[model samples]
Target: MVERVTATEETLQLLDKLKTIHGELMFHQSGGCCDGSSPMCYPRGEFRVGDSDIYLGDIGDTPFYMSKDQYEYWKHTQLIIDVVDGRGGMFSVEGPEGKRFLTRSRVFTEEERRELSIS
Candidate 1:
């Protein structure tokens, strides 16, 4: 059986704010520069699942998942969020310590978060 993971305080707040403004939120972790770790959040239907996907289950009406590879790399780290509001953006968590290789990231801004009661 697949193990279930609960969202963290930062992540849960971000999800709630996203839901209020964007209807539903989805999560994805893919390889990229800067230690090859990146986390993303967009409207529920905005993400496309790749072939090697690991299902992370639903957050209310939001369906969340990650690539099997991403799950393996980040299952043990803290989660952060990055929120985008049109051209404005904010990070839910940041700094050198919170940022690193194989680290969990979810960039969301304080303004966007507070505007949505997420911060």
Candidate 2:
């Protein structure tokens, strides 16, 4: 099955480093203000996933989530998690590392959209 979310090799390596330091981690993307649009990394259970959030698969072993309303706008695309040189969200674990989690996306192909039942 096709994955709804994936990460680059660089990102995977960074995630490994983070996991060693922070233990289990998770990601959340929301539509609210204050870094909500950016993928925020937190130690698992540090961030709560509401019933309205959608699980978008994982990057390495880290589960990724999106707000239900945000998912509505992004469901037609595939999420590509990447790492960039910058300060991450203030509350994110990566903030002190000077590397941020970035979200890149591509519109799913017609075949993939059909397979995923995305209208």
Clashes of each: 13, 0
Error of 2 at 107 (Å): 0.3
lDDT for model 2 comes to: 0.86
Name the top TM-score candidate. Answer: 2
Q: List the residue pairs that clash in candidate 2.
A: none
lDDT of each: 0.48, 0.86
Q: Write the per-residue lDDT of candidate 2 for residues 2-29, one digit (tens) a residue.
A: 7899999998999999999999999998
Model 2: residue 29 alpha-carbon error in angstroms: 0.8
- What is the C-alpha lDDT profile of model 1 across 48-85, one tens digit per residue? 78789877665444555677765565554334333332
Q: What is candidate 1's CA lDDT for residue 73?
A: 53
Could you tell me the TM-score of candidate 1? 0.49
Give per-model TM-scores: 0.49, 0.93
RMSD in Å for all candidates: 12.7, 2.5
